[model samples]
Target: MGRELVIGDIHGSYKAVKQILERAAVTATDRLIFLGDYVDGWGQSPEVIDYLLQLKSQFDCVFIRGNHDDLLLRWLKTGEYTEEWFNHGGRLTMEHYERLPADKRQLHILFLESLQDYYLDDDNRLFVHAGFTSLNGVKHEFFTRMFFWDRTLWETALCLDKSIGHNDPLYPKRFTHYKEIFIGHTPVTRIGETVPVQKANIWNVDTGAAFKGPLTIMDTGTKEYWQSDPVHELYPDEKGRN
Candidate 1:
């Protein structure tokens, strides 16, 4: 038996990813569930993907799609680099791809294309890159983009009145759908925390590796975790997504 590790948004910090995984002493038996945002932000966006591809060959891994990933996929397929995407870390990712051969770029495209919108485990824990909007649950989510772009679900969990019992009519139906939810998008650093935050039944593991924080990986079962040194420290010259 091995641990089930849920990793937060990477945002192209390959150095951070390597550091955290080694620090965690991850093995082939330990299942790695990545919460996405693997690219953009840092200068190593392309390198991150290469490392992830390599990891899949040696370990059990689950990849989730994110908003930045969707933007990257669209850019790869159409060569349409929008201003909004460029301003938000896409520029770094795009520039990296410029040096790659066509075959390597295609491989990245396939990997990105195959990412899941959400993953549900036997334990009934939900893993999504962002949040789902469906009251019934992820399977019934109306918009595909909501799985990677919606912040309302996290906001609802963060703002919910803890005094409201689970059975109360005032309780949000979305909260009742899973045993626990794990996500990464809006970083916990936004709330002044550099660690995973649990609000209601949701665990936010994104510790702001895209900017000044570190990349984190949590053992979903034990809730024990390991974090890389602050990403900015590892890549001191890069502006990252700051």
Candidate 2:
């Protein structure tokens, strides 16, 4: 059986991506579940996409859509963008992509279009860019945007009392729906930890590769993990959405 490795947000740090994958010794037989935010932050957005696309050809990979990814896709299709998006990492992402040939640019857009909002494996393990809010579970979620934008699920998990048993009526239902829930989107760095965090049944893999933290790849089975050096150190020349 192949190992399932859930990855944290890349945020365009292709260097960190490479480092962690190499350190993890990921084989073609392993399943790589990316939690998205592949772009936006570092200057290597285009490079990261290209690397992921190549990796897809070589291994079992699941790509989940992220808010920044959706934002970039919208601009790529319509050329309309909010000022907030531009200020945040869109401007830098655009600068690199502008150098892409039209055909290559379209390929990147198509890759983004093909991303999943969430994936449930045969084990009922749920992998998503962000958390879902529906009490019944992800399929019951009404807004696709919430898959990559919602923070409530993580917040609720954080607030969960460790003493609350699984059978407790007060236990979170959304968590009860799956054997394990893995997510990115919100950085664990926010809580001052530079590693993956486990709250309730949810594992937050996002170690803040977009800021000063390292990119992470964790084995879902063993919970063993590997990390690249801080993303900022990989690209000493860039501020990386800091």
- lDDT of model 1, residue 44: 93
Candidate 2 C-alpha error for residue 11, in Å: 0.3
lDDT of 1 by residue, 47-128 (tens): 9999999999999999999899899999999998789889999987888898899999999999999999999988999999
lDDT of each: 0.94, 0.94
Error of 1 at 131 (Å): 0.5
**What lDDT tens digits, residue by residue, belong to model 2 across residues 1-242?**
58999999999999999999999999978999999899999999999999999999999999999999999999999999999989889999989988889999999999999999999999999999888888999999998799999999999999999999889999988899999999998999999989999998999999999999999999999999999999999999999897
Show where candidate 2 strays beyond 4 Å: none
> Could you tell me which 10 consecutive residues in candidate 1 have the lowest summed lDDT?
158-167
Question: What TM-score quantifies how close candidate 1 is to the native fold?
Answer: 0.98
- For residue 106, what is the lDDT in candidate 1? 98
